[model samples]
Target chain A: MIVAERKPFDEIKNMVSGYKKVLTVGCGTCVAVCLAGGSKEVETLNAELNLAFGKDKIEFGAETVERQCDMEFLAELDAKADEYDALISMACGAGIQFLAERFPNKPVFPAVNTSFIGVNLDVGWYEEKCRACGTCVLGLTGGICPVTLCAKSLFNGPCGGTNQKSCEIDKDQPCAWYKIHERLAGQDRLGQIIEISPPNDWSNQKPRKVIQPGYEERVKALGR
Target chain B: MKSGSNLEKILKAGHFAFTGEVGPPRGANVEALREKVSYLKGNVDMANITDNQTAMVRMSSWAASIICMQEGVEPNFQMVCRDRNRLAMQADILGAYAHGIRNMLCLSGDHQQFGDHPQSKGVFDLDSMQLIGMVKKMRDEGKFLGGADIDGPPELFIGAAANPFAEPFEWRVHRLAKKVAAGADFVQTQCVFNMERIRAWVAQANDMGLTDKVAILPGITPMKSVGMAKYMKNKVPGMDVPDEIIKRLQGVDKKNVADEGIKIACEQIEEFKEMKGVAGVHLMAIEWEHKVPEIAERAGVLPRPEV
Candidate 1:
């Protein structure tokens, strides 16, 4: 679901201008799935860089690790750090930070812009969804996420911009407000749009520096 | 044949030249293919004999090229490297040379997964670029891909595929340049329906100096039906099936889709004839080989060059 885009070649070239030996590392996770920073893209980038700055001008290296997010993956690179002058990470923003943390001395440049977590509409196409605001509002909005659709992410009521059951911003697509109205209308509770709800508490949901636990905790406890 | 030989003659022959492709018939059945070539004798300048097209098991390209030559049709042998290793590829180059298949089109064959034999392991020991380089090495240095000396190399008029509408269009142009650098004499692109995209590609090719060195033949295929057009747009990679073409097909009566398809294809061919950097058109009708002459005639691509 993670969406990313490759940085332009000119910028990438400038980043590795002084480096004699460069390792272009690819992540086989979200970046790979989005086709931005996959193994093939890494190899192509390597070939292009070589072709641009003659093969003799740069001592280039390339590899793809399992996942740049995990410490285990970073540990695998311990044996080959000396062979590279700098590292270019083709992973999300978080994965790049993790790599930078692991290899403090080496300069690490991001090869992709971490766009958003979303769904692929077609092959090689993706649309943004779920801003990851550290809160879940699906219970009131139904399974169809209004957070990504709403012009203002207003959980309280339907916005005034809903025209002819379509969003004013994009007329081709349905309005989130119209959907909430329909849901309320279906349940014989048409007045739900007018129902006042308290504003979302921003103080209690401050961004934290650490992700305490993910899916691994359940697996570790089960020992499967 | 000397330097700048077969292709130079072919390119100069110019407009209205007809060509047809023969996907070598599988198993001990050369009769059908030979007959197809014979039918094309008075109509076409060359018969593009394919090498195991669609990843289907078939007669070798060199074998088919030799058969076509014997049948009085100049064969533009299509050679793919999906099934062969570097050794086999190099060996085949020499073998095709011995059999007199000078007009060679290099292809990275269809994946085995798409074919009936999905279990068969694909040996992509070298991609299209590597194969082009290997051929150039053999022809220019009189040596195999392995740096070993050869007695003499075949004089190959090399052609490679250019997929303009492939994802990341810039990369396709880069790939075409790489093929050119690898000594590709000409290019035959994937079926082009979107003329705007083709025009852009032609511009990029011109920018890359490919126009001067390589003759680019944009591949064209007629839309048989609305369903077939939809299927192709959805399934075929490197194919640009524009909306107008779809609407054009949809406007036709159900029974007349084939004729409509031919009309559209002929229009594209005619338009492409005047396009800059476009040397010719490579018509791929799949199984509908008979319509090629009609399409060519309609497109005003007439009078096959004197053989």
Candidate 2:
């Protein structure tokens, strides 16, 4: 559920200008679900690029390889490496880095801005939920990820900053703390608010790097 | 077959030629259009009547085509998919044909956001290619898009649009090929201000053998003024108007730009006539339909191709 916004077409066009043979690689998992790096989007971008600059100016190609993190899916692009001068990735920052790692010499550019992951409110609209903070606070926050909702990421109960159950930044939006209070009241555990959370640990950053073991076996088995 | 309609004869003839379009005014007034039809009746072989062009609410292309048909003018009814589905499209095509609106142009219209009704829901159940395929299926198989068999298949002379000047010139030829394969009898391209680009597109089309398969009618729109030309270039989708043409229009006197526009259109038609694959020209004077005949005559299309 990684949320992302598309980069403007003009900016993307300029990024791949140097390369005559370009492969637009999209991530089928997260980015696709978010409507960023899907098959349809890749097709549209391909068309846009072909229209702006003739196909001769840029021999553009498009393919949505599976999860960019999975080395197996990433290997699918290896066959096309010789055909492209560069790869334009339509995935999150982490996925783009993975692609860059896979094809060291070939340059990679991102066509989408990797925003926070969440659910779509409706068609062409999205709402942010998880921030992917390694430290789990759901146990204390009554299953609500306060890190994503709270502007201050307060682990404890209602902050004094709340004005009449509304967030300070946007008065119309109900304060995350106030909503947490309502949830706690319903659970008969308002006392849990007084239990202070420990100082946030910075070591959670190391877990961000996803490593898959026995990757070569999987790559060959998958026949990528 | 002795109905011998002008549109029928044109389709039967091998030479693909140019055409021009005019959107009828909003209201019911008919005098201005009458004047235009009277002037263009014999001058230009056919004129396209636009249907709620740009998704903007306006007088129907169907009704206007009916008027022009009665005036002895051949009309290509421009049908857009923004407001209708296969049902409406099929019904409209049948109705237009019944009313002698023989030539039909298929288009996936401009989105509602660009039009007056930004809040209006768009019905894109079928795109231009699907519409082309549907019409083709109807003609070839005697079956409607719904698979319901008709007593007799429609003998429609279908046309679709290709934007060679549409940004991404590489896919222009490919998209046109799809249209032809889908069943477009001919293509009325986006406006052509830059002949070099048009030549490139035509060359691509020829290389793909698409030029031999479908009639390619290059489009020419008379520039109202330098301002209008600039507006069109900046605003219109798939419409590419060169800077030199704008510069030429700018150099002319503003009051006489209409005449200059007609002159430019005539010049374009004359230039297109020399090209090998060009079937004809599609003139889009928009509201200025009266000038088409004069432009055609000036471009040497007036003796009109032998029927």
Candidate 3:
């Protein structure tokens, strides 16, 4: 899932400093699951902000939607748009962007730092798993990602910084290429690690948008 | 005759090669660089001009390499993928080639967190392996990475770094083979303090016939003090400075520690020459460039080949 973390309280406070009435919108999907921008978090932030700014003549409200990325769920804020001077979006970058598109006139601010697409390792611990590099070589790498996991993102093999099964950059982190090597060796596929991968095709540049033709055709045929 | 570099000529002639490093000045001043290169002119075959090494901003390696050429020494231009995109890298390659830089060392640079500007974004559009392959493609195919035709591709003697002390130690030689496959003409390793580990890695490389494919120059850094030795062992990533070496350094008086370091470096170089498949010793004197001549003389790599 798309992971995110709350921005510092000072930065969040500064973003809506002058706004008299502020609305904090939270996403209930990824951010909620990560315990970052869920309904409970939104309420806690709202109460904190109100307590901090009450003497400064400011009011705050909190609400959460099913998924901030979808326009359908975001439409729930339209009726309350006129009640607040500004809005704080506690969601991933994509959700924040979509929220801004929904409320063109209202001042929309992101209250979180969109980290990466990762899985929860444990409670409050997340590790990045994918880079969405358009090309996936997991089949050859034995289900490990050298692209996102290796500090150097080396395709052919690990850099000289791997030490005792950990990365040389940070000893706490496991070396991705080492893990891939172990995985491939376990499967008796060590030969795969030596094959030279061609230069990465970066044609799928950033801010990328995709359209599923089959889904689009189905929607069009349904005439909905 | 790739790049017609002296280093390449010496290695091609089957003579033991000796390369030295010259870090560009932190500022734009070239006098300090010239002074450092002076010590290396007759003592080494080629000098590696570092590119923002350790992520600290310095004069571009391209410029420093040209300065080396001006000082009558061949330069191995070091490039890291941390600071530039493909367009910038290609442009610099053409510029460096035009300015007479024949050799290039491709590296995945140190992470920015270690540098002065930790807040900066790293532009690793290509990893070191990909960069090596890209440079080879440009030179051999006479085409850019995007397959665009170049009027004249940069002819370079490609070099890459290796670290024998890094973990999954058994895989080091295989990684070196991969680099050679990616188009490295030669390989220079991280500083060697653990000779046993390096000897094992070299033996593996010999068994795999990798030593025959690419020239391998093991890195040697003279320990300036016991503190420096401890720092390398504890702080420097991928460096394996054995505890015995640190203890040896501790045995020396503070004033004689630098000499002890040089003595150890000389011993490593001598042993490196006898190792099968070893090409040369890359003496990285760091800031003590003045001591390179003495180190080279003591190690018997002096009177460097003129080829």
Candidate 4:
């Protein structure tokens, strides 16, 4: 899931300082699940901004939708959001960009910083899980993503800095390769990791587009 | 004549080799570098010039290595994957070779987080294993990683760092073999203090017949004092310092603790000499270069073997 962190109160407050009526928008998906841009968080930020602005200096409204990245959910606030002087999005980067796109006349501001694609290790804690590098070698590495876990993202094996099952970076951080080797050794699949890996393919054609296969077929059939 | 380096010739002759290291000064203090280089000139077979050791910036290893050459000491230029990308590394390899450097040690550098500038970005476009393979490609096949044929390829002896004492003790040997597979012609293990653990690590490495495949030189960093010993035992990652040695250093007079540390380092080298598959010792007197000559003499590896 995409993880995000809320921008500083001062920064958010300063962004909507000139706007008389500002709506703090929230997304119900990744940012909401991460507790940064949920409806309740939006309410808290709305009240904080109102109080910080003091007595009628600015009017603030809080609203949340299923997901801002999706156009359908964004349609709910498409017309309603434009009435405000500005819109502040408390979603990931994509959501904030989409919100700005949906309400072109109103200024759109981000209230949260999108962190990473990660998993919740526990409540209130998240760790990065993938790099979306377009190449996946998880099967070859015994279920571990050396690309994400290893500090250097080394695929061959652990560097000499792997210490006592921990990384040279820090003792608390377990070396990713150690875990890979352990998992592979247990499965008698160590040979998989022993093989050399060529350099990763990072074909950097930016802002890449991928149309889902079935959806592409449907669109082709419609010929719209 | 892979590299035609003095270190390579000694190892090729089946003679026990001795190598020492020198960390370049933080700035352009050539006098400081030369002083350390002079201390190690005739002491060891070749001096390993470190690149940003401990993640701190220093004189460039290739530049310092060229200086070592001017000072009459052959340099085993160490390149870490932390600081540069493939283009810069390959470019530097050609440049270093042009300056008469024949030896190169590949390492996945210490993380930038542990450096003077923690906020600085790290450019690990290639890890150490890949770096080794890439260098070998340049040397053996006369081809760049981008698969372009080179005008004049660098003839080099590839070196890599091995940490037998790190973790998953059973797998460390296999890890060394993996390095060997990556085209490492030789290697220097992480610093050793616990002889028994490294012995076990080497035993496993020998069982896999890795000793014959590559020259294995275990690193030896002598403790400077009781505090240094304790700090290494507790703070330094991938370093194994036994408590007994710490106790031994502590048992000495405060001034002579360094001597005791040197004695202990000598003792470790003594053990390494008797161990099978161990081809050499990389004495990392870190900042204590002056002590290397004395330590080498006392360790019974003196009258440095002439290849």
Candidate 5:
């Protein structure tokens, strides 16, 4: 899931300081799962902002959508768009961008920092699982993402800093290459890591867009 | 005679090559580096200028290598994949080469958490092995990492680090073999305190014929005191300091611990000299550079070859 964390309190306060009426929009998807932004988080932020502003000079409200990325769910906010001076988006980068695109006139501020696509390790613990590099090599590395796990993002093998199966950088973290080696060795597929990977093609170009081929044809046929 | 660097010449001539390390100053001050280089002059074959070794910011190894060259000391330029991408790495390699640096050591470097700035993002675009391969390609093929032509290729004697003491110990020699296959001309290992493990690793390398493929230089850092010994043994990851050595240090008087450390280091050097497939010794005195001359002299690596 696309994980995110709330921006610092001071930064969020500064972003909404001049606004007299503000709406805090939360996403019930990845941000909620990561405990960064959800309906409860939005209420907490709204209450905090009200207390920080004091004197009731600014009115704060909170709302949450099923998924901020979906245009249908975003339609729920269109009815109250003109009632608020500013909108605070407690969603990932993609969500904030989508929200901004929906309400082009109103100022949209992001309340959280989109971190990475990761998985929940335990309660309150999240580990990055993918870089969205657009090139997948998990089949080669026994399903471990070296591009995101290895500190050096090494594709070939482990570096000299692998100590006791842990990373030399952060002793608490297991060395990604070490884990890959162990997994491949256990599976009797050690030859995969030994083979040098060609340089990444970097196909994840910026602002890239893709449309489902059959969906485009279906849309054209259904056109009124 | 790769790059014809003094270290390479000494190693090629079958002499016990001695290489010293010099950490670049945090600021732009070159006087400290110059003094260290001058102090190490004639006492060692090459002076390795570290590249922000533990991730603490310092004068770049590329600039320090040039400074060392100015001080009449050939430099073994150390580069880590932590700070630069492939483009920056290839550019710096050419820059170092233009500055007359011949020997290059590729390392993955200590994590940023160990350095002063733990928050900085690491740029490990390529690991040490890939870095070695890239350097090899640039030098041998006269092309950049992306396979673009260079006006003049850098003639480099590539070096890679090995930690025989690191865990999954069985794979250490095979890792060294991979580095050699990737174009590492020589291999300098992590500091050696466990001689039995090092001997076993060397034997494994010999069995794999890796010893003949690349020159293996074991790293040695003389402990300054019992505290230093404990830190390396316990705190430093992958460092294997045997109990007997700690006991030996603990047996000595507080003031005599430094000398005891030197004595132990000298013994290790002597053992390395006799070990099969061992090429030389890389003496890392840490901040105790003044004692390197004494350690080298005591280890009979003095009167460095004038090649």
Candidate 6:
């Protein structure tokens, strides 16, 4: 899921300080689960902002939709969003950009910073899982992604930096190659580790439009 | 006579080649660098100029290699994949070659977090293997990584590093073989205090015929003191300082600890000389460069074979 954290109050305050009437729009999806832009979080932020501004400094209202990135949910905001001088989006970066595009005339500001595509480790805890490097080598590396975990993104073998299964960068960070070696060894698949991996093609990093396999023709037909 | 380096000549002559390491000073103190280089001059066939070792900022290897050359000492210039992209890597090779550097060692440098600048960005566009392959491509095929032509290719005697004592012990020999296959002409193993493990690793490499494919130089570091031994054992990444060696260091008197360390290093060198598939010894007397000559002499590798 897309993990995000709320921006510091000072920065958020500064962003909406100029507006007399502001609506805090929160997403009900990824950011909500991460506790950044859910309805409860939006209400808490609004209450805090109300306390800081007293009643006269700024007028604050809060609303949350099923998903802010989707146009259908954004259409709901479009109906009542016209009265506000500005908007504070408590969603992932994609949601903030879509909200801005939907209400282009109004000033749309982000209330949270979208971090990475990650898995929720525990309540309010997250760890990055993938870098979207386009080409995946997980199958070749015993399910560990060296592209994301290895500090140098080394492909051939572990560098001389693997010490006691820890990375040279931080003792807490496990060495990706060491883990790969262990996993491959456990599966009796260590022979493949010696095979040389050619340099990755970074051309896959260019902004891509990936259409779901079977829906490509239908999408193309519906497109301009 | 690839690159025609003196080290290459000595190894090719079937003599046990000797090499020392010189870490460039943090600042551009050319005089200090010259003094350090002088310590290894004429004592070893070649001296390796380290590239930002420990990820600490220092004078670059190529620049120090020039200084070593000017001081009548041959340099085995080191390059790490941590700092440069492929473009910069190829450019540095051409530039360093123009400066008369003949020997080059490819490495995946120590992470930046281990250095003074912990927050620095890591630009490992290529690992050491890829770097070795790229160097070979430029040298043999006379082409750039982009498959474009090079006006003049750098004829370098390529070297790579290995840590036989590192984790997943069974993979160590195969790792070295992969490096040899990557176009490395020679290899220097990580500092070896675990003699038994290094011995086994080398034997495995011999079985795989890596000795015929590439020159293997077992690395030796003469610890300065018991504290240094403990640091290398406990703190340094990829190091395997056996407890018995540490016990030996602890057995010595405080004043005699350094001598004991030198003794241990010299013994390792003698053993490596007798071991099959062992092409040479790379002595890294860190910050104790002046003692390399003594170590080389006591180890009976001196007079440098006149190659």
Question: What lDDT is reached at residue B198 by model 4?
Answer: 88
Model 5 C-alpha lDDT per residue in residues B225-293, reported as the tens digit of each score? 888889887788778899999999999998899999999999999998988899998989998787777
| Residue-level lDDT tens digits of model 4 in B1-307 | 8799989999999888999999999999999999998988777999999999889999999999999999988899999999998999999999999999999999999889999999987878888888999999999999999999999999999999988777778777877888899899999988888888888888888889999899999999988988888888788887788788888888889999888888888888888888899999998997898887788888887787777
Native interface contacts retained, candidate 3: 0.58
DockQ of 5: 0.56
Candidate 5 off by > 4 Å: A8-10, A51-56, A122-124, A202-205, A212-224
Candidate 3: where are CA atoms >4 Å away?
Answer: A218-224
Off by over 4 Å in 1: A1-224, B1-7, B13-18
Cα lDDT, model 1, residue B120: 83
TM-score for candidate 5: 0.93
Error of 6 at B298 (Å): 1.8
Q: Assess the local accuracy of residue B257 in candidate 4 as a C-alpha lDDT between 0 and 100.
A: 88
Once superposed on the true structure, which residue ranges of model 6 sit more than 4 Å away at CA?
A212-224
Per residue, candidate 1 scores C-alpha lDDT tens digits across B149-249 of 89977788777877777544544565576667777887887778888888988999888888877888888788778988898776553356888889988
Residue lDDT tens for model 2, A62-114: 88887897889998888887788899999888889999999999999999998
Q: Candidates sorted by lDDT, descending order?
A: 6, 3, 4, 5, 2, 1
Winner of 2 and 5 under DockQ:
5
State the lDDT of candidate 3 residue by residue for A1-224, as single tens digits: 99999999989998999989888999999999998999989998888888878845788888999999999999998999789889999999999999999999999999999999999999889989998888898998999998799876767777666677888678898989889989898899989878888767765586675658668887778686
Candidate 5 residue lDDT tens string, A74-142: 999999878998999999999999999999999999999999999999977998999988889999999
Which 10 successive residues of model 5 chain B have the least lDDT summed? Answer: B166-175
DockQ of 3: 0.63
TM-score of every model? 0.57, 0.58, 0.95, 0.95, 0.93, 0.94
Expressed as tens digits, the lDDT of each residue in B1-307 for candidate 6 is 7788888888888999888899988999999999998888889888899999988999988998999999988999999988888988899999999989999999999988888888988887888888999999999999998899999899999999999988788888888988888899989989999999998998999899889989999999998898999998888888898899989999989999999999999888889889999999898888999988788889998687786
